[model samples]
Target: MGRRHYILPDCQIRPGDPTDHLDWIAADIIRRKPDVIVCIGDFFDFPSLSSYSTPGGVEKEGARIKADLDAGHAGLERLMAPIHAERERLRTGHRKRWEPRLIYTFGNHEERIDRPAKEDARFQGVLGTHLCEVERFGFERYEFLVPVEVDGVWYSHYWQSSHSPRPIGGTVDNRLNKLGFSFVAGHEQGLRYTNRPLPNGKTLHGLVAGSCYLVTEGYRGPQASNEWRGVVVLNDVRDGNMAIPMSLDLQYLCREYAGEELQAYMDKRYPDKDWSHLA
Candidate 1:
């Protein structure tokens, strides 16, 4: 329950990353100026921990599935630079100040690091016991993809309704339908927004964000078109209650007001594409 919480869903950063939306997001953050920014999980795709990883592929100095730790750092840097710049600008602006707390929730793909540490004692904790190497970037890290509550709304990598007698399907609507509280999550990579009435004169809404990756390679293919490619902006929050204003979706923002440069990037990526469905 913050005054404003901007939710950025799973990125699964590696190859073909820092998607066109990354630029749009950085620019949008400067314009919207939220109270907090939450990167909801799967920020990294440690292919080394993938169950389908090939030993030979891992051995080569290069591999399609393997991710580079340094590149991940670079990608984070590119995405965060604008936010930092804006903060500095506001600190010395004519009057009003601007500074939004940054947060990252570790998702299941990030947990891939656990397998190596568990299987081999020698490699255990060899690297820092965290997902993002840029922990020095002044972000509060949440482990196990635990959701954080602000203004009564929950933000997490994904919602696991353990309270339910049995498991519910993994989808935005499924989680919102089963859980009593409103939440925003990423990891399912699909966009679903639903709201239902409550007996207490309130309503519950669930928002599943789209991905920020450039393309899908394997399991993430086929249905990749269904995955959204933007961020979610939450504002006017009061006691965890909020109203969608200015922008409710990042992709919507980019499509509506994106600069020609970004449009060119999308055009090159999808030359034969039509986005009438998004309209």
Candidate 2:
């Protein structure tokens, strides 16, 4: 059997996304039982660092950063819990040889941690360095530019190789035409795919596996159709054969796929109110 990998890109965790979508995928991940799962990038949205955030000057910047970090941390735990459990169960019991791994790619937003250190000297080592530490999350981490390879496809935050002209941009078609290889990345929202036929009866593919979150910006156009929310799943991935991002309905998914009642977690916290619209 070929290796399977689930590509979840750009989950800009701040106010965060509903656990239901991730919960549902965790169930499927348990079943598909992929050898690797890639949380492709920008898992955290450091809103405080945005130029738009502090247009005039930095106000309560520390507080804003802390809040984003806190939410991001909590969101990370929720997203990783089921995958962690399944991975451990497989290694500890029935499948001793199976070594399932969780891979997290640091996108530009997550890189917001570095800017503080770059600008200030005394505060360089003081804070915003947690991106370097991934042990708690049980994930193998990669920087924004470092590409992680699966069976064949490469996962990176963005694609603009020095070998190429300049930057062909982040669109799937642009990447496929420029790099002549399969790639999956985030930073740009919305699901886009490009498939090219090879001479060997094989199909090469590239995917812009978009973001999953509730936050929307006015800058992303009034309708915001350019952005998308979902995860990409690749089964038997080899030589770039890929799956398009499947738009998710976390509520419906949790109801149908989640092995455990996600509502149980919500019920205790929010005794009243239907949280079907979470994220």
Instruction: Judging by TM-score against the true structure, name the best candidate.
Output: 1
Best by lDDT: 2
Cα lDDT tens digits for candidate 1, 192-240: 6777667887877777774766555555445445445667777777655
Off by over 4 Å in 2: 15-20, 55-63, 90-98, 161-167, 225-227, 242-255, 258-279
For every candidate, C-alpha RMSD to the true structure in Å: 4.1, 4.6
Q: For residues 1-279, could you state the per-residue lDDT of candidate 2 as single tens digits?
A: 566787777777764334445656667667666788788778787777775565545542454677877778877777668777866787788685545677888888887887788789866776554643665887887876788888778888877667763335755676787778777777777777778888987777888765775444545655553355666677677656755434443334555674435455455555664434332
Measured on C-alpha atoms, candidate 2 has an lDDT of 0.68
